[model samples]
Target: MNSINRILIAGSFLLLAACSPKIYGTVQLVDANLQPIQAAQDSPQGSIVNMINTTGSIGQSSHAVTVDVEGKFESEKEKVTPGMYKVEASRIGYATETETVEIKKFTGKKIEFKLKKILEGKRATIKGAASDEDKIINPGEVSIQPPSM
Candidate 1:
C-alpha cells in the first residue's frame, strides 16, 4: 500500500481505539455494621496512610483514592466497560473482607465492604451431657476443667 493509504489506515485504527469506552468503579470503607467511615486525615503519603494506620485496612484497592472529606467513597465515572474485579478491604486491627464487583459500559455500580475489628479477647466455654445411649462406654463420665491457674 502507498504511504497515504498506510497513514489513512493508521488514523482509522486510532480513531476506533479512541472511540472505545472505559469502565471504572470505586472501593468504599465501612464499619462492621456497614456505616460510612471518615477518610483519613493528612499524612506524608496521604490519607491512605491514616486509613491504614487508624483502621488498619486499606481501601479494597489502590485505585479508589481516599476521600477524607466525604465519608463515602467516590471514583471517576468513565465510559462503558465490562469486567469483574475482586474488591478488597484491609485494616491493621480488623478483619478484612473482599467482594467481586461487576462494571458495565454506560452504567455505574457500587461495591461496599464492611470490615470488622480483629477480636483480641480471652474467653472460653464448654458444656456437655450424657444419656442412656451413652452408658456403654468403658468409663462413661463427663468432666469439665478450667485452667489450672
Candidate 2:
C-alpha cells in the first residue's frame, strides 16, 4: 500500500507537468495595402514564427516553428510554459513583425502578425542611350554628350 501511494503521487505530478500552456498564431505576408501576398506557385514555405519567453532564461525559452503555406502555426501541446513571451514573425522580402503575449496554464493564446513587403529602390535606366543593342546603359559607362545646335 505504501508503494502504491508513492506511485499515485508520482503520476499526479507527471500529469501536472504535462499540462503546460500553448501558443499559436498565423503570420501573413502582406503588401502595402495589407493584402495577403499571393505566391506564384502553391508551395511557398519560408516564413518563420518565434516565441521568446521574456520571463525565462535566454536560449532555453525560445521556441521556433515554420509557418505553413497558408501562414498558420501552432505550438506543440504542453510545450510552452505559462509566462510572457515576445512573438516574432518573418519572411523573405517582408519586414519582420512582433507582438507580446501572455501565456496561461491550461489555456492557449493566438497571435496574428501582418508583415509588410520591403520596398526596393527603383533602378535607374537610360532608355535611348547610343551604346548597346539592349538600350540600357550601365551606370559606370555613362557618357554625357553635348547636343549639336
Candidate 3:
C-alpha cells in the first residue's frame, strides 16, 4: 500500500513539471564602437525584430538572430533545454556578429551587437560582359559619392 502511494505522488510531480514553461535569455544590437544605438528613429514598429536560425556543425548549430534598428533585442520566453547557443545578429548592409550564450533555467540574458560598416569599400567597380567573347571587363568603377539628393 505504501509503494502505491509513492508511485502516485511521483507521477503527479512529473506531470506538473512537464506542463511548466521555461524562459531563456535576450540579445541586443550595438554599434561598432560598442555603443548602444537605438534602432532607427523612424522605425515603424515599436519593438526590435530578431530573426533566429541555426548554423555551425551538426547538433552544434548556432542560433543566428538579427535585429534592425538600434535597440536591445529579446527572444520569446521559450522552454529550451539548457545548452550553449551561438547567437548572431543579421541586418542588411551591416556586418553580422555572433556571441555565445548560455541558457539557464530562469534568468534571462542581454546580448549586444555592434553595427559595423556594411559597405566593403568606398568605391565599387561596375563590371560588364564583353559581347566579343565571354570575357569579363570592368566597364567603370562607381565611386560612392553621396549626392546632394
Q: Best lDDT goes to which candidate?
A: 2
Q: Answer with 1 or 3, whichever has the higher lDDT.
A: 3
Please give, for residues 71-146, the per-residue lDDT of candidate 3 as tens digits: 4455543423455555655555456666666655545556545555343668888987757588754669645677
Ranking by lDDT: 2, 3, 1
How accurate locally, in lDDT, is each candidate? 0.45, 0.79, 0.49
Clashes of 2: 0
Q: Which stretches of candidate 3 lie over 4 Å from their true place?
A: 1-70, 120-149
Residue lDDT tens for model 1, 49-119? 11111211343223434423333444433322445555445545545666655654444555444555444
Worst 10 residues of 3 by lDDT: 41-50
Better of 1 and 2 by TM-score: 2
In model 2, the worst 10-residue window by lDDT is: 37-46
Residue 6 of model 1, lDDT score: 98
Candidate 2 lDDT by residue in tens digits, 21-133:
87887776777888777776322266888889989766558898888877789887655788898988888788899889998877778888888988888999866756667
